[model samples]
Target: MKFLYIFTRSAYGNSIAREALDMALASAAFDQEVSLVFAQEAIYQLVMQQNSANTEKKPHLGVINALPLYDIDDIYYLAEDSSTYNLPPAALVPQAKALSAEQFSSLMSSADRIQSF
Candidate 1:
Protein backbone atom coordinates (compact mmCIF):
# COMPACT_ATOMS: atom_id res chain seq x y z
CA MET A 1 0.00 0.00 0.00
CA LYS A 2 1.01 3.58 -0.49
CA PHE A 3 0.59 6.29 2.14
CA LEU A 4 0.83 10.03 1.91
CA TYR A 5 1.17 11.69 5.28
CA ILE A 6 0.52 15.41 5.57
CA PHE A 7 1.66 17.30 8.62
CA THR A 8 0.78 20.95 9.28
CA ARG A 9 2.06 21.65 12.75
CA SER A 10 5.23 23.04 14.16
CA ALA A 11 7.82 20.66 15.60
CA TYR A 12 8.11 22.14 19.08
CA GLY A 13 4.56 23.16 19.95
CA ASN A 14 2.61 19.98 19.24
CA SER A 15 2.80 16.21 18.97
CA ILE A 16 1.31 16.09 15.46
CA ALA A 17 4.65 16.37 13.69
CA ARG A 18 6.19 13.62 15.80
CA GLU A 19 3.15 11.41 15.33
CA ALA A 20 3.27 11.86 11.57
CA LEU A 21 6.96 11.09 11.51
CA ASP A 22 6.39 7.94 13.54
CA MET A 23 3.59 6.88 11.22
CA ALA A 24 5.81 7.39 8.20
CA LEU A 25 8.53 5.28 9.78
CA ALA A 26 6.02 2.56 10.66
CA SER A 27 4.67 2.52 7.12
CA ALA A 28 8.16 2.18 5.74
CA ALA A 29 8.86 -0.66 8.18
CA PHE A 30 5.91 -2.54 6.71
CA ASP A 31 7.54 -2.13 3.27
CA GLN A 32 4.85 0.29 2.18
CA GLU A 33 5.77 3.24 0.02
CA VAL A 34 5.50 6.33 2.21
CA SER A 35 5.43 9.96 1.17
CA LEU A 36 5.66 12.88 3.58
CA VAL A 37 4.25 16.36 2.93
CA PHE A 38 4.94 19.30 5.16
CA ALA A 39 2.46 22.10 4.80
CA GLN A 40 1.54 25.35 6.61
CA GLU A 41 3.10 25.35 10.04
CA ALA A 42 4.80 22.04 9.39
CA ILE A 43 7.21 23.79 7.03
CA TYR A 44 8.90 25.19 10.11
CA GLN A 45 10.09 21.71 11.03
CA LEU A 46 12.46 21.47 8.10
CA VAL A 47 14.29 24.73 8.69
CA MET A 48 17.94 24.06 9.48
CA GLN A 49 18.36 26.33 12.48
CA GLN A 50 15.92 25.65 15.26
CA ASN A 51 17.04 26.43 18.78
CA SER A 52 14.67 25.15 21.42
CA ALA A 53 16.96 26.02 24.29
CA ASN A 54 14.80 28.81 25.65
CA THR A 55 11.63 26.80 25.45
CA GLU A 56 10.56 23.86 27.57
CA LYS A 57 9.78 21.78 24.53
CA LYS A 58 12.03 19.49 22.55
CA PRO A 59 12.34 19.59 18.77
CA HIS A 60 11.64 16.74 16.30
CA LEU A 61 14.47 17.66 13.98
CA GLY A 62 16.38 14.57 15.12
CA VAL A 63 13.50 12.30 14.17
CA ILE A 64 12.91 14.02 10.83
CA ASN A 65 16.59 14.03 10.02
CA ALA A 66 16.74 10.27 10.53
CA LEU A 67 13.99 9.33 8.05
CA PRO A 68 16.42 8.63 5.21
CA LEU A 69 18.12 5.87 7.23
CA TYR A 70 14.80 4.02 7.28
CA ASP A 71 14.32 4.29 3.51
CA ILE A 72 11.69 7.02 3.80
CA ASP A 73 13.23 9.33 1.26
CA ASP A 74 10.22 10.68 -0.60
CA ILE A 75 9.65 13.72 1.56
CA TYR A 76 8.26 17.01 0.28
CA TYR A 77 7.37 20.46 1.58
CA LEU A 78 4.77 22.71 0.00
CA ALA A 79 6.51 25.51 -1.82
CA GLU A 80 3.72 28.01 -1.33
CA ASP A 81 3.45 27.18 2.32
CA SER A 82 7.16 27.71 2.69
CA SER A 83 6.89 31.06 0.99
CA THR A 84 3.92 32.05 3.09
CA TYR A 85 5.91 31.28 6.21
CA ASN A 86 8.94 33.15 4.85
CA LEU A 87 11.09 30.02 4.76
CA PRO A 88 13.58 29.66 1.97
CA PRO A 89 13.66 26.24 0.30
CA ALA A 90 17.44 26.29 0.28
CA ALA A 91 17.55 26.29 4.09
CA LEU A 92 15.47 23.15 4.60
CA VAL A 93 16.78 19.75 5.56
CA PRO A 94 18.47 18.14 2.56
CA GLN A 95 16.32 15.01 2.78
CA ALA A 96 13.20 16.65 1.32
CA LYS A 97 12.02 18.14 -1.93
CA ALA A 98 10.25 21.48 -1.94
CA LEU A 99 7.31 21.31 -4.33
CA SER A 100 5.16 24.02 -5.81
CA ALA A 101 1.42 24.00 -5.09
CA GLU A 102 0.76 22.39 -8.47
CA GLN A 103 3.31 19.66 -7.90
CA PHE A 104 2.00 18.93 -4.43
CA SER A 105 -1.53 18.70 -5.75
CA SER A 106 -0.37 16.15 -8.29
CA LEU A 107 1.33 14.17 -5.56
CA MET A 108 -1.85 14.07 -3.52
CA SER A 109 -3.78 12.84 -6.51
CA SER A 110 -1.33 9.99 -6.97
CA ALA A 111 -1.53 8.74 -3.40
CA ASP A 112 -3.57 5.67 -2.45
CA ARG A 113 -4.38 7.18 0.94
CA ILE A 114 -3.71 10.52 2.56
CA GLN A 115 -3.54 10.97 6.32
CA SER A 116 -3.46 14.56 7.44
CA PHE A 117 -2.66 16.02 10.82
Candidate 2:
Protein backbone atom coordinates (compact mmCIF):
# COMPACT_ATOMS: atom_id res chain seq x y z
CA MET A 1 0.00 0.00 0.00
CA LYS A 2 1.09 3.59 -0.54
CA PHE A 3 1.93 5.36 2.73
CA LEU A 4 2.05 9.10 3.08
CA TYR A 5 3.68 10.85 6.04
CA ILE A 6 2.96 14.50 6.68
CA PHE A 7 5.25 16.46 8.97
CA THR A 8 4.19 19.88 10.33
CA ARG A 9 6.73 20.70 13.00
CA SER A 10 10.24 22.03 13.28
CA ALA A 11 13.22 19.70 13.22
CA TYR A 12 14.66 20.45 16.67
CA GLY A 13 13.63 21.37 20.21
CA ASN A 14 11.54 18.21 20.24
CA SER A 15 11.56 14.60 19.10
CA ILE A 16 8.43 14.65 16.95
CA ALA A 17 10.19 15.24 13.66
CA ARG A 18 12.77 12.53 14.23
CA GLU A 19 10.16 10.10 15.45
CA ALA A 20 8.12 10.69 12.30
CA LEU A 21 11.17 10.21 10.12
CA ASP A 22 11.98 6.94 11.88
CA MET A 23 8.47 5.69 11.26
CA ALA A 24 8.60 6.72 7.59
CA LEU A 25 11.94 4.96 7.18
CA ALA A 26 10.68 1.87 8.94
CA SER A 27 7.71 1.78 6.59
CA ALA A 28 10.07 1.83 3.63
CA ALA A 29 12.21 -0.95 5.12
CA PHE A 30 9.12 -3.10 5.18
CA ASP A 31 8.85 -2.54 1.41
CA GLN A 32 6.03 -0.02 1.59
CA GLU A 33 5.79 2.85 -0.89
CA VAL A 34 6.46 5.94 1.26
CA SER A 35 5.99 9.59 0.44
CA LEU A 36 6.93 12.37 2.87
CA VAL A 37 5.47 15.88 2.84
CA PHE A 38 6.88 18.67 4.98
CA ALA A 39 4.32 21.35 5.63
CA GLN A 40 3.75 24.42 7.85
CA GLU A 41 6.75 24.88 10.10
CA ALA A 42 8.02 21.52 9.00
CA ILE A 43 9.37 23.20 5.88
CA TYR A 44 12.26 24.35 8.02
CA GLN A 45 13.37 20.77 8.25
CA LEU A 46 14.24 20.90 4.56
CA VAL A 47 16.21 24.14 4.67
CA MET A 48 19.83 23.68 3.75
CA GLN A 49 21.18 25.78 6.63
CA GLN A 50 19.68 24.06 9.65
CA ASN A 51 21.50 25.06 12.82
CA SER A 52 20.55 22.93 15.78
CA ALA A 53 23.72 23.99 17.51
CA ASN A 54 22.02 24.97 20.77
CA THR A 55 19.62 22.07 20.87
CA GLU A 56 20.35 18.75 22.55
CA LYS A 57 18.72 16.85 19.73
CA LYS A 58 21.11 15.79 17.01
CA PRO A 59 20.53 17.69 13.78
CA HIS A 60 17.79 15.82 11.97
CA LEU A 61 18.96 16.79 8.49
CA GLY A 62 21.45 13.96 8.44
CA VAL A 63 18.63 11.44 8.47
CA ILE A 64 16.62 13.43 5.93
CA ASN A 65 19.55 13.58 3.55
CA ALA A 66 19.86 9.82 3.68
CA LEU A 67 16.27 9.22 2.67
CA PRO A 68 17.05 8.60 -1.00
CA LEU A 69 19.53 5.90 -0.03
CA TYR A 70 16.68 4.08 1.67
CA ASP A 71 14.77 4.15 -1.63
CA ILE A 72 12.30 6.67 -0.17
CA ASP A 73 12.55 9.52 -2.64
CA ASP A 74 9.06 10.95 -2.88
CA ILE A 75 9.77 13.98 -0.69
CA TYR A 76 7.83 17.22 -1.06
CA TYR A 77 6.96 20.54 0.55
CA LEU A 78 4.04 22.92 -0.05
CA ALA A 79 5.02 25.58 -2.53
CA GLU A 80 2.76 28.26 -1.07
CA ASP A 81 4.07 27.77 2.43
CA SER A 82 7.64 27.71 1.20
CA SER A 83 7.26 31.09 -0.45
CA THR A 84 5.35 32.58 2.47
CA TYR A 85 8.17 31.44 4.71
CA ASN A 86 10.63 33.04 2.25
CA LEU A 87 12.33 29.74 1.60
CA PRO A 88 13.92 29.96 -1.81
CA PRO A 89 13.79 26.74 -3.78
CA ALA A 90 17.57 26.67 -3.81
CA ALA A 91 17.63 26.61 -0.01
CA LEU A 92 15.70 23.37 0.29
CA VAL A 93 17.26 19.90 0.30
CA PRO A 94 17.79 18.49 -3.16
CA GLN A 95 15.47 15.59 -2.58
CA ALA A 96 12.53 17.86 -1.77
CA LYS A 97 10.21 18.79 -4.60
CA ALA A 98 7.75 21.68 -4.40
CA LEU A 99 4.16 20.57 -4.67
CA SER A 100 1.37 22.89 -5.68
CA ALA A 101 -1.85 22.99 -3.68
CA GLU A 102 -3.75 20.97 -6.23
CA GLN A 103 -0.96 18.43 -6.42
CA PHE A 104 -0.87 18.12 -2.64
CA SER A 105 -4.60 17.55 -2.58
CA SER A 106 -4.36 14.91 -5.26
CA LEU A 107 -1.54 13.23 -3.42
CA MET A 108 -3.62 13.00 -0.25
CA SER A 109 -6.46 11.60 -2.25
CA SER A 110 -4.24 8.94 -3.77
CA ALA A 111 -2.55 7.68 -0.63
CA ASP A 112 -3.78 4.38 0.74
CA ARG A 113 -2.69 5.37 4.25
CA ILE A 114 -1.59 8.68 5.68
CA GLN A 115 0.05 9.56 9.00
CA SER A 116 0.29 13.20 10.05
CA PHE A 117 2.70 14.47 12.72
Candidate 3:
Protein backbone atom coordinates (compact mmCIF):
# COMPACT_ATOMS: atom_id res chain seq x y z
CA MET A 1 0.00 0.00 0.00
CA LYS A 2 1.01 3.61 -0.48
CA PHE A 3 1.39 5.47 2.79
CA LEU A 4 1.67 9.21 3.15
CA TYR A 5 3.08 10.55 6.39
CA ILE A 6 2.24 14.18 7.09
CA PHE A 7 4.36 15.96 9.65
CA THR A 8 2.92 19.21 11.00
CA ARG A 9 5.15 19.71 14.02
CA SER A 10 8.75 20.61 14.66
CA ALA A 11 11.33 17.91 15.26
CA TYR A 12 12.54 19.52 18.47
CA GLY A 13 10.67 19.83 21.80
CA ASN A 14 8.80 16.62 21.05
CA SER A 15 9.12 13.07 19.71
CA ILE A 16 6.37 13.20 17.10
CA ALA A 17 8.76 13.87 14.23
CA ARG A 18 10.96 10.95 15.18
CA GLU A 19 7.93 8.75 15.54
CA ALA A 20 6.77 9.72 12.09
CA LEU A 21 10.18 8.91 10.63
CA ASP A 22 10.18 5.55 12.32
CA MET A 23 6.77 4.79 10.91
CA ALA A 24 7.90 5.74 7.42
CA LEU A 25 10.99 3.58 7.71
CA ALA A 26 8.98 0.64 8.97
CA SER A 27 6.49 0.99 6.18
CA ALA A 28 9.27 1.05 3.61
CA ALA A 29 10.92 -1.96 5.21
CA PHE A 30 7.72 -3.89 4.70
CA ASP A 31 8.05 -3.21 0.97
CA GLN A 32 5.37 -0.56 1.00
CA GLU A 33 5.64 2.76 -0.77
CA VAL A 34 6.09 5.62 1.70
CA SER A 35 5.98 9.34 1.09
CA LEU A 36 6.64 12.12 3.58
CA VAL A 37 5.01 15.55 3.62
CA PHE A 38 6.30 18.32 5.85
CA ALA A 39 4.01 21.29 6.40
CA GLN A 40 3.64 24.09 8.92
CA GLU A 41 6.36 23.93 11.56
CA ALA A 42 7.33 20.54 10.31
CA ILE A 43 9.21 22.29 7.53
CA TYR A 44 11.91 23.02 10.09
CA GLN A 45 12.77 19.36 10.15
CA LEU A 46 14.21 19.65 6.65
CA VAL A 47 16.37 22.66 7.36
CA MET A 48 19.99 21.68 7.00
CA GLN A 49 22.71 22.24 9.62
CA GLN A 50 20.63 21.83 12.75
CA ASN A 51 22.42 21.79 16.10
CA SER A 52 20.78 19.94 18.96
CA ALA A 53 23.83 19.40 21.14
CA ASN A 54 22.84 22.00 23.73
CA THR A 55 19.45 20.41 24.28
CA GLU A 56 20.88 16.86 24.34
CA LYS A 57 18.23 15.88 21.81
CA LYS A 58 19.36 13.65 18.99
CA PRO A 59 19.64 15.49 15.71
CA HIS A 60 17.08 14.34 13.14
CA LEU A 61 19.33 14.81 10.12
CA GLY A 62 20.67 11.29 10.54
CA VAL A 63 17.19 9.86 10.30
CA ILE A 64 16.28 12.13 7.44
CA ASN A 65 19.32 10.99 5.55
CA ALA A 66 18.44 7.39 6.16
CA LEU A 67 15.12 7.77 4.35
CA PRO A 68 16.81 7.27 1.01
CA LEU A 69 18.51 4.13 2.23
CA TYR A 70 15.13 2.72 3.11
CA ASP A 71 13.77 3.60 -0.35
CA ILE A 72 11.54 6.33 1.09
CA ASP A 73 12.69 9.23 -1.01
CA ASP A 74 9.40 10.94 -1.71
CA ILE A 75 9.93 13.90 0.60
CA TYR A 76 7.97 17.07 0.04
CA TYR A 77 7.33 20.39 1.79
CA LEU A 78 4.59 22.93 1.20
CA ALA A 79 5.80 25.83 -0.93
CA GLU A 80 3.55 28.22 0.99
CA ASP A 81 5.10 27.22 4.29
CA SER A 82 8.63 27.49 2.90
CA SER A 83 7.90 30.94 1.50
CA THR A 84 6.29 32.12 4.74
CA TYR A 85 9.34 30.97 6.67
CA ASN A 86 11.70 32.52 4.13
CA LEU A 87 13.28 29.14 3.47
CA PRO A 88 15.02 29.04 0.15
CA PRO A 89 15.35 25.73 -1.67
CA ALA A 90 19.04 25.69 -0.91
CA ALA A 91 18.29 25.92 2.81
CA LEU A 92 16.57 22.56 2.87
CA VAL A 93 18.00 19.07 2.77
CA PRO A 94 18.97 17.92 -0.71
CA GLN A 95 16.10 15.49 -1.07
CA ALA A 96 13.28 17.80 -0.06
CA LYS A 97 10.97 18.97 -2.83
CA ALA A 98 8.82 22.09 -2.59
CA LEU A 99 5.25 21.59 -3.73
CA SER A 100 2.45 24.05 -4.14
CA ALA A 101 -0.50 23.79 -1.73
CA GLU A 102 -2.66 22.33 -4.48
CA GLN A 103 -0.02 19.74 -5.35
CA PHE A 104 0.34 18.82 -1.71
CA SER A 105 -3.39 18.30 -1.39
CA SER A 106 -3.40 16.19 -4.54
CA LEU A 107 -0.64 14.02 -3.16
CA MET A 108 -2.53 13.41 0.09
CA SER A 109 -5.61 12.48 -1.85
CA SER A 110 -3.65 10.04 -4.01
CA ALA A 111 -2.30 8.11 -1.04
CA ASP A 112 -3.93 4.86 -0.01
CA ARG A 113 -3.44 5.72 3.66
CA ILE A 114 -2.57 8.93 5.43
CA GLN A 115 -0.93 9.34 8.84
CA SER A 116 -0.35 12.72 10.42
CA PHE A 117 2.17 13.60 13.07
User: Which prediction has the highest lDDT against the true structure?
Assistant: 2
Q: How many collisions per candidate?
A: 0, 0, 0
- lDDT to native, each model: 0.86, 0.93, 0.91
- Per-residue lDDT over 31-72 for candidate 2, one digit per residue giving the tens place of the 0 to 100 score: 999999999999999999988878866888899999998899
Once fitted onto the true fold, the runs of candidate 2 whose alpha carbons sit more than 4 angstroms away are none
Candidate 1 C-alpha lDDT tens digits along 1-117: 879999988887877677778888999999998999988888888988888777766666788888888888898998788778988877899888989888888988999989998
Per-residue lDDT of 59 in model 1: 61
How do all models score by TM-score?
0.91, 0.96, 0.96
Candidate number that wins on lDDT, 1 or 3: 3
TM-score of 1: 0.91
lDDT of 3 by residue, 1-117 (tens): 989999999888688888878988999999999999998999999999799898798888999988899998899998899889899889999999999978988998899999999
For model 3, the superposed segments whose C-alpha errors exceed 4 Å read: none
